[model samples]
Target: MINYKSTLIPALLIIVAIACNRPKAAPAKGNAVWDSVLQNVQTAPVKEEDASECIKLNGQIQANEDHQAKVYALASGKIKSVNVALGDKVQKNQTLAVLQSMEIAASSNDLVLAESNVAMTKKNLETTKDLYEGNLATSRDYTSAQVDYNKALSELNRAKQVQAITGGRNAVYELKAPLSGYVIERNISGNSQVRQDNSNPLFTVADLSNVWVIANVYESDISRIHNGDAVSVTTLANPNTPLDGKIDKIYNVLDPATRTMKVRISMPNPNNTLMPDMFVTVKVNAQPASSMLTIPSQAIVLDNSKNFVVVKDAKGLHKKEITVIKRVDPKAYIQGLSAGEQVVTNSQVFIYQALSE
Candidate 1:
């Protein structure tokens, strides 16, 4: 009670110190000279540079369907032996499995008959030609022999073609890969009964050297995308690895369910790391804009359908309408802004509000 006056003086000084240390808010209405510095408003000059616009899309990694093959038994048979397992790498024309069937045996017999007929008819043609030259055979008889020889030759040619597809040695058929690739599927095993009419195939061999990136282009983005656009694909499993590719195909029709058109990009997968059905992000690089002027996105103010920016000049701040050509985050490519011009990057909304009033 004796130091009440001293206590009152110290409390008042503390109150005044707290008030001076607090941060000040930007004024509602003020000129650059009056309050811009006090509000800490900043400006940056417009710059010109070559910049690329990219559209990011979600897609999936798939085996290049064109470079893949489905192995089907040439004829109905029971699988005798499966020589390869799933994920096994195989070379072109490598035998993958062996099958045993009466159908295969019948094909072998037909090939043998065709061969025998060719040999027998060839001998007859030689004899008949000699007889005709010696005046011992009629012209019609020689012609008949020639026709038989031609028929036998045609049959033999057809048989050889069939035999290549339906390979059989002692009623066992060998299923061979058509291309060098890893085995993606194994539908048949030892002693499994495979049918020629079955919908499913025995194995799927796919060349993993290059893969397909299938992306869906929405209706809004379809007009901007074109074939041969550069694309970068990254997988979530290994985000550090990015694969480069190009758009090779854009389907003409739209998907009924998704209402998006499918686009295909070919990506090189030399390491065999990109697997089918892996989710990935595809960044399609659009044509670069040359010497476009850009400013910080925060400087531009959107009003209704029109956009404006606050320009600080010798006179003061003034609002100028601008047309945004493209926008990358934090920057906008605009038509009205000139290079070397100063525009407010922050606290522009305060200027916009005062100008609107």
Candidate 2:
């Protein structure tokens, strides 16, 4: 009560000063200055036309089965020498390793013995035939000689066939590549015992010139994918590189655990840059649907709570709230916007900042 009059007058004066001196909010978004700047910004009308949609999924690069080979041991043996390691490129029929097998040695000895018998029997058959014609030997004797000679010849042929199939000489056998490719895996090392019936292969070779992209389509997205659909594949390992391919196969089986179906895409790897098990991104372009309102993706400005775009008209610029339906790269399908409307496509941050104030 003692100072009420003095404080009240000063408070009233302060309020009047603030009211007079406080700056006014800047003129609405598109003044003459903004119009000049807007000249530099590109604008495009929202188009109502069928637009292709794309489905994105995570996938892995795999070697094409048709171009891949799994090399197994032809016979039980000890690995003598491994000529190729993982990632080594090899040519067709190139020896990948050598195996030391006692069984092969026995086969080699038998082949040598069979050759010698064939040579000896040929001479004996010639002599026996001549003796029979000259009356120097009985018919029974000639017949017995001919039958034994034929039997020995058959045995020699069998031994040769075995040697040819096994690719063995002395006590060693060679494991050769069936196709030209890079070795992606090596299961057996030098001096390792390998069995003929091993469930796994000793080496895996792939002609990486062509590869497969395996993508999992969730149960919900399976309907959008089909065989022969065009797709693009990319990898984080090499972001600049993108591979084009098509859906070559769709597996009938669904993975019960993952609730997804496998989709196979064959992609050409001209530089052999793609490798098996490399994580990759797959995008399949789905067919365009009926026309809808769409705008360039950059035109929309996102804020704390909503997305907005600056629409220009004879009246000037105004902020318009929009509902984005589906966004593809560089384009956005949206609602609350109409076709033939002019929306700011670039420098949105500058326009938005000026107007927000």
Candidate 3:
């Protein structure tokens, strides 16, 4: 109980002092001043886009007339003449070379002889008939002469046809070209054994005025390609110049090995520039269905988890979060940012930092 009154009075006086002269707590980390500064520095407003277009794509160059051929001789005889050389231009029905062999000519001569003999017998039979009517010639004699004449007529007709070319006929022959084109290949030289041997071709010809640009289309895009679709192509050799063409055909079946479909395009190789088996790039333009919202790329700022744009929202000063679809040519095509929203175009990063604090 010693000094109880004294201790109670001192405690009450200390409480009274705290209430009368209380020290103010420190200011919070963020407040109105930071917001005001960000608003002052906000960039100029964003403008709406006026037009849209297709994306530029890549393509390749191709040869139109790269033909592969296999040739065989019709008449078997040692090769006589090979007029066309490899890579020589030839005309349609042009004589490539003349083949010489005793076998072919002999058949024709035999046919001529048979026809002459037939003519002689016909004259003799007429005389025999006249004599038989007079009874001056015996029946057996007349009959024998008639039978011999009939046999002669059949032999003469057979000779004219030249049926036995394999063994009976031997003569020089001429082999003519099937079409007019550049001779890409020739198996026969000055004198090679060309007795109907299929292992060799006399010559291979191709027309190269126009070229085919064959492109390998991935299976995913197979459905999008069709006949007459517009296409653009470029080559690694001459990438600066691009060629225009249309899809001539799209193969129905996909290649199992490459998982690609063959798309054929027809383009002129004027001055004969393009070649076969060259690798190239190809692009087919696909039509779009709807429109997309776009603006100059500088308007958007991305941070942490969300992309933001310093926008003048319902609240006097604030930052807006948006979704960016794609960035093309200093312009950002977006989905979430609506049309007519005023977005800060130039200074998004500084504003974001100011707003954060």
Name the top lDDT candidate: 2
**lDDT tens digits, residues 102-198, model 1?**
8878878888999999999999999999999999999999999999999999999998888886877568889999999999888987888989898
TM, every model: 0.66, 0.82, 0.54
Candidate 1, which segments miss by more than 4 Å at Cα? 1-51, 117-154, 289-357
Ranking by TM-score: 2, 1, 3
Count clashing residue pairs in model 1: 0
The C-alpha stretches of model 2 lying farther than 4 A from their native spots are 1-44, 134-140, 301-307, 345-357
Ranking by lDDT: 2, 1, 3
Global lDDT of each model?
0.82, 0.83, 0.64
Cα misplacement distance, residue 150 of candidate 2 (Å): 2.5
TM-score of 2: 0.82
Choose 1 or 2, whichever is better by lDDT: 2
**How badly does each model clash, as a count of residue pairs?**
0, 0, 20
Q: How far does residue 161 in candidate 2 sit from its true spot (Å)?
A: 1.4
Which of candidates 1 and 3 is the stronger one according to lDDT? 1
- What is the model-wide C-alpha lDDT for candidate 3? 0.64
